[model samples]
Target: MKLLLITAIEEFEKDVINILKNSRLKAFSYQSVKGFKNDKNEMKNWFGKDDIAVDSLLFTVFSEYNCVDSIYKNINEFNSMQQTVPHIHIVTINLEDENFR
Candidate 1:
């Protein structure tokens, strides 16, 4: 089992969720997170619109490694669909228990 952690703009949450669902991966956790970009003193837009700001954190678990690439690809496609560049972070980890909350 592995955990795929991603931090993205709040507006992209739904798109990410949909991609996960379509990828057939289940069970995840998320929270509203406030964070800034790597570049400070500069504001950027996702699709050249609203100013950059803190968004959401997306955490999901996958039981298989095979699904990783597909999940990422779908997310990239979704971001492109919205005419926005993908600004996501990915983390893979092994889990000791399924009951973790």
Candidate 2:
């Protein structure tokens, strides 16, 4: 199995979900989280109209490697279409049975 993790601004959560829905994966889990961004990032400090700028961390497991590949492609397409959006990070991890059991 493999784990697909997508981390991005809260505003992009729906876009990520839409991309996931179009993929072969069956389900996923996501939640809000607090994190700091570099001074050069769009979020900057936590004292403006955007507040703390919580991130939406979405993740799921793919039983097949192709699923991960497809999702990464979809995510890249999504990223390319946006110019003003903050940088999002996508990671795919291979999981071993021993790590869980």
Candidate 3:
């Protein structure tokens, strides 16, 4: 198994979720988060307001490595077809083992 993590703009969460679901990749977890780029000072537009401080949607999914391609494709499509926005991090790692509640 493998783990996939994606951090993207908040407004895109719903679209991301839909894309994931449509891709037949279910059984995942997600949350909304507030964060900023390392060069926030350079991106003055993101400063001075709580609402515009930079918020993103984070999603975590555990699946076969092949699933990564589909997810990445979906995300890329979403970004290109929609308005360009915040930074995103896509982390994929092997899952040695697991326990769940």
Candidate 1 structure lDDT: 0.64
State model 3's lDDT.
0.69
Per-residue CA lDDT of model 3 for 9-95, tens digit only, reads 776677778877876775889988776545645644332234444667779888766678888887777656654445345678888
**RMSD over all Cα atoms, model 3:** 4.2
lDDT of 2 by residue, 64-91 (tens): 5667777788888877877754645677
Note the Cα lDDT for every prediction shown: 0.64, 0.66, 0.69
Pairwise lDDT winner, candidates 2 and 3 = 3
Itemize residue pairs with steric clashes in candidate 3. none
Instruction: Give model 2 RMSD, 1 decimal.
Output: 4.5
TM-score of every prediction relative to native: 0.65, 0.72, 0.72
Q: Per-residue lDDT tens digits of candidate 1, residues 1-101?
A: 67788666777677667777787875666777865555534444322233455656665555477778888887666655665553555567777677544
Error of 1 at 99 (Å): 8.5
lDDT of 2 at 22: 80
| Pairs of residues clashing in candidate 1 | none
